[model samples]
Target chain A: MASSYSIILAILAAAAAGLVGAFALMKRTILAGDVMSHIAIPGLGLALLFAWDPLVGGGLTLFLGILIIWQLQKKTELSAEAAIGVIFASSVALGALLIHSDEALVDALFGGFKNLTPAEFAFGAGASILIIVALWLLRNKLIISLFSPELAISSGINVDRINLWYLLLFGLAILANLRFLGALLVGSLIIIPAAVSRQLTHSLGTFLTTSVIVSVLSMLIGTFIAMHYNLDTGATVVVTAAAFFVLSLFKKKR
Target chain B: MQPALTVLNIEVSFDGKNVLEDVSMELGAGESLAVIGPNGAGKTVFLRALLGMIPYRGTITWAPKTRIGYVPQKIDADRHLPVNFKNLFAAKASILKLPAADIEEVIEIVGLNNNIITTSVGHLSGGEFQRGLIAFALLGKPSVLIFDEPTASIDVAGEEQIYDLIHRLQDAQGITTIVVSHDLSFVYQYATKVLCLNRAGVCFGEPDIALTPEALEKLYGPHKYFHYFNDSHSDDHRTKNHDIQQ
Candidate 1:
């Protein structure tokens, strides 16, 4: 059975994921975000080894990874996927090497249903709210940059700084859910809902709203089903989101 | 005709290889300058350099308070993207803190209707998309407009319309226009000055004077098209390639 705090944190995280995913899908960075989630694995491993707070450790490495990827993208002019590729492989390998226990490894890969303490819940909720608010404020700039970076620059918007802020927000979104969805499955929560929303809508305003709604619904229903069936919560959530995507395919967008 | 832009011996290089070297040009206020060259002739590079999108080793002076609006050759917009021109315009408007009236004004100036602007970008026709880009560039009341191949993807008839729109915008708004174009006829007709580029400044002056057969051959290499410009042109060849002759 899931605790109330876990459910609340999961819902908040899902909302953030939905918002982030909408932009990531448009920016064509959804897949890169998947790989970005894995960058946290090494940090989780180090935390587990040192008996440190896993979220903190994961966040440190996730942000470091984001900064490195941002710099690589700026300096090397590689696409986000190419830059994420440079970091993804090594991070996963290091994580695998450091995480000695198989159970710990499994938990890190596909999250464990651990009851959250009041502090953990607070931290998670704060991060989720920050992601939502920041993305809301940045949405207009994000839209322009995703549409055309050159146009954004010509508009006097700093494309690089906006990109950095987005990447950081993307990292923050991943970090907030790293405990709930794990490194392997969390990206799907972000990607699938937005994808489903895209399939159903043809306008930005509705697309964003639909994605958040689908994401929250998936999290709530997935939690209920997982608790009832005694199934893995993260997997159940992802599978639920995937089911939405499958259904969206039937309603062909005009 | 006070100079709106003055460039002196600009050079741009990437990875130790020079893409543009010793290129120079000048543009008077309200002048339509056409930049023409064969593919990979640093035409886009020159534009980027002027726009300050890339670092260059020269002085480029734009008259103070000169705002530039750019229309790129193409944007590989994702088909599934749920953004329309309205969303895009709103986004830009919000970013620049421009009033909504400015958006309405640009939409009217570009002749884009509410229906077309509201349609998803992926669903828009090539002409519609081009018009949307023009409207986008027209935002913020830019004093200068730079276009990279404004009609590269449009059909022939659409191309003519796009050229007409650009020419009209220039004339009506008195916006200093710098266009990278492949259509020599449009260049000859509309360009107040022409810059023929090929990794260097091959020629620069009025289109009729600077765009001689010798100058064009130097810029694009020897082609049968150059024969059309020669005073001793053959009627047979002109009839054969009437489009190029034009």
Candidate 2:
């Protein structure tokens, strides 16, 4: 039996993921974002080992991963995908070695929908709202910067600073959903909905809106299916989102 | 009156290798300056330095209140991107906190119609896309227009139209123009001054006076100079001098 609070939080997080995913897809960083989530695995494993709050540990390492990726790109002049790929492989290995218990590892890898306490709901919902609002405010800058960094620089926008902000917000979005979606599949929610929406829409506004709709639909449907069949919520939600993407491929892009 | 721009002994390097060295030039207000060079001659790098997009050693100065509008050579945009010209214009306008009327004015100036503005950027033709970029640069009413090969992607006929449009914009607005061009004819037609670069300032002055046969030969290796002029003009001797004022 899923609590209404848990469902509400999940829905809000889905909307946030949808918005973030739209920008990620447009920036061609969707795959990089998937790998970015893996950096949180080692943190989750450490928290389990030490009996600390798992989300707190995940948040710290995710923040470190974000900074490392940003600095790697800046210093090495490597593309974001390449920089993230380097960090992702090491973080996954470290996480695998740290988590000694199989059951805890499964719980960390494929998240379950547990009853949400008021504090957890408040924190998760607050993070979701923060991501959504920050993205909305930064959308115009992000649009121009992603289109052309040279043009954005000439237009008086601080492109590097904007990129850093985007990376931070992207990490926050992942952290907000890490408890429910887990590291393995959380990035899929952020990648698949926007992909589906991209196939269907041809304008920025439509693309963002449709992505949010698809993400929310996936969350709701996946939750129901999970509760009914006693299946994993995170895996089911990601699969549902992937299903939407496959169906969207059938619609001829105009 | 003060000069519109001045670059003094500018030097840019990457990985300890100097891409541009001892490059210097000046442009007066309402003047059109053409930067000519062979491939990898640091022409684009010079433009980036001028725009303050990259760091360089020497001083590059623009007069106070000098707002620059830049049209880059090419945009490697994703073809399936959902953004249209209108969306890009609106985004720039919003970032600059400009009024909607400003967008309409630029659209009219660049001769972009509603259909073109509504179409996705990747879908627009080469000429239409170039016009859209020019229109984007026109926003915020910049005092200087900097173009990096404005017609690189355009066809032969479209190149002429783009040049004419740039020439017209200069005449109508009296804005300072700095263009990096490969077309010798364009330099003679529109530029008030020309700076020939080959890792350094090889020559700087009016087209006919500074671009001597010897200078052209030095800037573009002798073989390339002969081939370029011979392919375009009828006589080799006349091509050497290239009396473009005709």
Best by TM-score: 2
Error of 1 at B39 (Å): 1.1
What global local distance difference test value does model 1 have? 0.86
lDDT of 2 by residue, A80-135 (tens): 55657778888888998999998888878888889677877898899999999999
Q: What is the interface RMSD of each candidate, in Å?
A: 0.9, 0.8
Q: Ignoring the other chain, what TM-score does chain B have in each prediction?
A: 0.90, 0.92
Question: What local lDDT score does residue B19 receive in model 1, on the 0 to 100 scale?
Answer: 93
CA RMSD for every model? 4.8, 5.0
lDDT of 1 by residue, B175-229 (tens): 9999998778878889999998899999999998998888888886788445434
B131-207 in candidate 2: lDDT tens per residue?
A: 99999999999999999988776666777888998998889999899999888888888999999999999999888
Q: Which residue pairs clash within candidate 1?
A: none
Q: Which stretches of candidate 1 lie over 4 Å from their true place?
A: A75-83, B227-246
* DockQ scores of the candidates: 0.70, 0.70
lDDT of each: 0.86, 0.86
